[model samples]
Target: MATPARTTQAATTRPVRYAPHLYNDDLAPVRKRTWGTYSIFALWMADTHAISNYTFAAGLFVLGLAAWQVFLALLVGITIVYIGMNLMGHAGHRTGVPFPVLARVSFGVYGANIPALIRAIIAIAWYGIQTWLASVALVVLAVQVFPGLSPHTTNDVLGLSTLGWAAFGFMWLVQLLILSRGMETIRKVQDWATGPLVWIIMLFLAGWLLIKAGFDISLTDSLTDLPASEQWRQSIAAVGLTIATFMTLILNYGDFARFTKSHRAYRRGNLLGLPLNFSLFALASVLTTAGAIAVFGEAITEPVEIVARIDNPWVTLVGAITFIVATVGINIVANFVSPAYDLANLAPKYLNFKRGGLISAVLAVLVMPWELYSNPVVVNYFLGGLAAFLAPLVAILLVDYYLVRRGHIVVDDLFTDETSAAYYYRRGFNPIALQAFLPAAVVSGVLALVPAFSAVAPFSWVLGVGIAGGIYYWRSGRVRTGPLPNEVIACASSSSTPTGSTPAPS
Candidate 1:
């Protein structure tokens, strides 16, 4: 008989694969596929069916454009969103990892911290802002239910009333409770929250517009006065801004896409979630905002305010629930999940998923996000600046993945301590990515911020992403990627030595 193969001794032999403990198995990919086309469809509903989204739809007319121009802007803007989502989804599906882990490619074993922090900070800020916006609805609901609350609302400080604080705190508690559970709970919650809002908003818009049509407020009234030149300029800006806004979601999308079963599943989800879903929601929002204006005698920018003024308690309640759901959906996805992964990235050894997210939530309150709520212009400017910074990061990552490695990474090496890990270029960090990104990002930032160059602000994200991608590709294209799963760092005593390793104890 052939001699029995000697089993590798545990003490003498290293493991063949490095498991990325970047996340708990709770997030591990499951073979049973769950999210279908409808669920994917509902995701964008939750994102776009909110109060802010409705206002944005109606406000597009403020660009002094015809209704057709507004529609064109919305379509082009959302199309870009569709494309960006797919681009990021590929990475999410490939390694079964989220944004922060995928970030390790561009940011490095340790350097991923920079992008992680940037993404986390932005998510927390938006979370607080969205939470506060949703709280306004709660405030209206409280006044509706308890007329006595009218008396406690008088004291105003720093652009918010005492009732606003009370409402915000209550909403904050509600969010904390939802987040107390893991992300699976959030996925289910979002599924339930979006559909009804879309239906109600659509029905409401149709009902109002029908009445307006009977009174002869034809579409022509809305279309005839728009100047083509101004409309085109605004529409172009709108398209770019919409793409940039969606790009932010793309940057951290692996956070959600990690749950996908296959690349096909990822693409299916993107098609349903982005293009189809966003298009319908944007149409509904625009119609409702316009119809509300015709019916109410003045434009109502807030969904809660529009619903509140209605005499039908049932209709108002439906609107209230819808807005609440939409707000919660964005809050969990954009705010809660992102910061959690980001903080976890920072201290994989220290903070687990839930605690890292909770820490972010708490600090968000301390930041007094209410300060940011007072000015929409300020918020837009800040968001624009952030997009400029992040676009470069995404560019570098995409170029590195697609062109440099030809869309391959040794996933196992993500957890390795080996000196020659495929990812361990110059001590677990890639300086060339940084070198390319910093200059491109800075240029984009200046363009966004400086008033004279602000006309091109809408294009900053694309410009930054492109420049960084090209620069990084130029620098690192010559380096050969190591073979096998990214986890296979060479043995500490292997031929290829990591340059930046701490010298063996002097």
Candidate 2:
């Protein structure tokens, strides 16, 4: 095991020559780690406070479990996510590298691109879906405010109506503008604007529904007609699904954590953002769903649908706009940022952050995510498949960082293409890591896709994580406790050896 080195300013401040094929400003260690507790807190706020999250929580309530049972599941599942996020985040905070760059330690400098592309593809799918979701809210508001637009909503073109296309285009443009401004601008927007704005709207909507329903809402009331045994089974399934929902973020959490000032700050933000914030959001979702049922005579799971049913046009408009903002916020943080860094890592010489983001955006549009999201069967298969691949990757990463390497990565070797460098195993690829990832991912994918293993499908993420982590751990042989090779203790101790300097050829 590599010994943990002393924290050093030289890691960030020293000037080191980087291989042209391996370095870019976006992939380098951050010189100024400006993010604090609130930034992380707000990041989760934006990520969790979205239409999809609201609907997912509301859908769980309709599974016939008592409110407390669902909450218990949420608490447990989110707690696990909290722990995972901390592990991933701490690595980035300590190493000062983004997710893809960090992966080079385990996956080999070049092999890391495989996982990076996989993650980037998933992000693109999500980016399109989220962008479409946000647009729906705008379409709803536009048709309500201007009756003339109703025709355009029904006149279909390329699977979407004219109004839908317009809304999607508008949303796509807005997100592009924000992303072009860079990560700091995104952090500021989430922290000060979208995060707080959505919370207020959610609280207000829940209160209004409660008051309108005559305060008769009860979480204990069964919403589904299923048998009690099946309800419990479904409840358990919901726990897994809930975890799967955020697995992507949990895996790449280091992307955001690298910007954080300290481990404590990251944990503090996660505590507020995951468990506390998510619990409150879940409660609001349940209450809002129950209230909608009582008043509307049917369960309205979608927030946009609920808002549309409101008699007050002004209030409805506000709700629509808020949902748009919330969805956009989540899309940028959860989907856009991950791929931007991942794709940029693929070819640092050619692609910078902005260019990578643009590629992702274009691919998102080409995929026509609206079609994928509109069909429930497709959405399930797509998300399940994503979990299958992602699960093993997460497991491998955790094992490599926490167990094998012992949280000690040679910062300079991460940017070197030389065969002698620690990360450049076998011509810049680690066959061991690939061997571990492939079979695990294949088995997990089979479980998700095969009907015989359908019952086990929900737990695909957990299963993958376990299988991959175990395989990597066992295959790597006995753990080593010696100090890491080429480890830089601190900036002051080793100013001569810059963190980005290229290593001599083997």
Candidate 3:
């Protein structure tokens, strides 16, 4: 949790004649920062309480580790996430700027779009996958409620059934409607009800499964007997995989963190939400899955599948809806809002948040994520290849903000292309970032795409981050003329807008 020096309030918040190409109301410094610790906690709840996480958590149990070992891995992994998110969020909290805007400090005014578009494109793909996942729950509810709908469940169009398409469309529209309302609505829904409801539903499901299992669930029996060294290696890999799962959200944490009220509150919320909350959820998920094995004679990893087996329409309806809500929570925050900011950063003159969200939604459909999700090869090469770029970008941003710039951001320069501006290096592009990014991205991409390198694919993020950060730090030395002027540093540190001090207007 490095507390970067704050950009001056007047420089960031006061009205300035910023170029239309680089500035918009949504991308501008937040008018007020009022999100408290609980809100931040709920944000993680929304992010992690998803269908994917439920399945991922359960899958970790079979990774040749004991139940306690799995929990230990989860704690270690999420703690790393907690630390990374805090670091990413501090910049946003200090400057009241979104991720893409803050990115301009390192990537240059226009170069920022490179990372922005990459993140947005990846998020759009995930948005579709999550939308499809949520729609599956809806389809289950529809068939259960209307037995007549069974015939339509047959695959008819583009590998999706008529009912599936209808359900998907309905869910897609519902999410868009929610997103169009604004971030405030998103925060309230996720914080007040959606996250807690999932917890209650999951707890109920876990309790029911426990009763059905006669309290004889085994969390570790399925794990294969392996050498202690092998188990330790596997446990470490599990931790890496857990951290890798949140790579998308970690990169853009600043999008939500900009609204947080204080560093202390932000850290407290992250501590509570990430490692603590996820550990609790992991316990419930692992127990529920283990219970499924005891009763159903198989490890039922999918919560929807477990609900479907209950032989009660009411339970099915309630469980299906809860899964949908959980998926929706993650989709909007993790997939939808990120691309909205990223795409808006690309062309702020024309694309506001709502319009950007619309564009993302439409493009998600065009990607036909069912095809992508269903095909393992495509999932490996296509999505993985794009994702390989994220680590290096993360490294560059962190290195530039904390190291190269010494935690100083010239707020005005981020929006301007003037030759004299601090960030206007080599025509709105930082050659060092490009130099650092390309090789790291290439190596990660190779690891993701090459069949022979599959064994080491999981470590691509660590490799990319280390390589890019090192290169950027090394290359910056050549271009580093001197430290910023004392007055600039003083203005940033003495900014009137203390971190998260202002109350948001009602």
Candidate 4:
């Protein structure tokens, strides 16, 4: 008889032979779910303690609301994200597949590409934006350290300056090198870049600013006070924007959840990582910027600008490097990884993670994100538009997995185009799901873009989810064909092991 070790090895290796059109090592179900609670916690630590988040959080305080009101709004928004992440993460933990593959359960194998491409486009845009944000720090440092380089910052080629291009290219190359080593390397980078260093830096910045301001700062002081109705409206808008900031991650959370060891671990990780951690970081941002108003005679939302004003090279250098590292951590985890999996899902036979990631990076440069980032109107439009697009997709996937399918997935069928396969709907497209998603997305999109409906733009995600999920649930009940009874099911219960076809962690 074969030894148990050999038998286990055979079981794990066998699934690698799934259809070439869907079977690449990067796109395959992960064999080992090794990421633990701390890794999950660190993932959020990396995501939140970045320059963009700092600016975003700081911007919230000036929206004609008290600090406590902003916090309350953020609490509401973040709680929603925590719940959405858990719901989105469950299918990945059970099936050990990425977002694209998990999407195949509801969208047929070929039609899954629609959501995948949509997500990829969003990631690519943000990747460029974050890269541009990080490069700004480099420009600040370069001008400070080498005064002669200050002129190079002004001669704009296209939209960015000569120095801006150099800094952006350098940051891009650093990210590419880290990504070339794959997920483990990215996780390791996140662990180191974020954990304590970022928190320490944030705290130090807040403390120093408070000292410079003689501890005289107020969170209620707004640039322009508005009527109570306007205050409430903007506060609600703040909540919506906070939720919008996370819609991309909320939709494709399986990209991280697939690495988690158990459903319990995934929940524990998201609990610590999202609401609690994010709240503290938001507090730090508000405190630091409020102190800046007292000291600088004007409110400065940019941390790099605050750091630049201090007459200390060592402080500036450390701040720049830490911010850059923190920004890079989030960029790779949130932006780079999503598109890599998404693009690979488009053509698994021709592309894997590295190649897909490379394609994303190339597209990042072509988008000229600096122009997009500089315009406030464009940024808001971008956020509202993408949130509308993402919300429907997220709703469909969550409803199909937990309610409709009852937490069961025929993992093998997700890879096959066989006529009899459970997921292989007409020409590899699920008409019911498509019917539900299209109308909902279109309505949400139109509402966000139309000037008359501008008041509802911030709540686009809510609108899309309600419309899409409601329609899909009703349509799914009417449909005769669903999951085949005889196929292998990845057990959804927390207590039971997944089917034996899923390889156990070695």
- Candidate with best TM-score: 2
| Tens digits of lDDT, candidate 1, 39-129 | 5556666676666666676687544555556777878788778877777777665555667767777767677778889888888988888
- Model 4: residue 152 alpha-carbon error in angstroms: 2.9
lDDT scores for all predictions?
0.68, 0.81, 0.80, 0.81
Error of 2 at 410 (Å): 0.4
lDDT of candidate model 4 versus the reference = 0.81
**CA RMSD, predictions in order:** 7.5, 5.1, 5.1, 4.8
Ten consecutive residues with minimal summed lDDT in candidate 2? Answer: 489-498
Clashes of 3: 0
**Cα-based TM-score, every candidate:** 0.87, 0.92, 0.91, 0.91
Candidate 3, residues 1-506, lDDT tens digits: the string is: 12222243323343223567887778877776668899989988888888777887788775556667777888999999898888887777766778998888887888888999989989999899999988878887888788899999986798799999999999999999999987888888889757787898899889998998888866556456877898788778778777777777778988888777777778898998999999889878888888887888887889988988998878888888888888999898889998999999988888989999999999999999998899998887765565478889888988776777655555655666667677778888888889999999999889867989877777777888998999999988843333454212212222323332222111
Comparing candidate 1 with candidate 4, which one achieves the higher TM-score? 4
lDDT of 1 at 18: 40
Give every collision pair in model 4.
none
Clashes of each: 8, 3, 0, 0
Give the candidates in order of TM-score, highest first. Answer: 2, 3, 4, 1
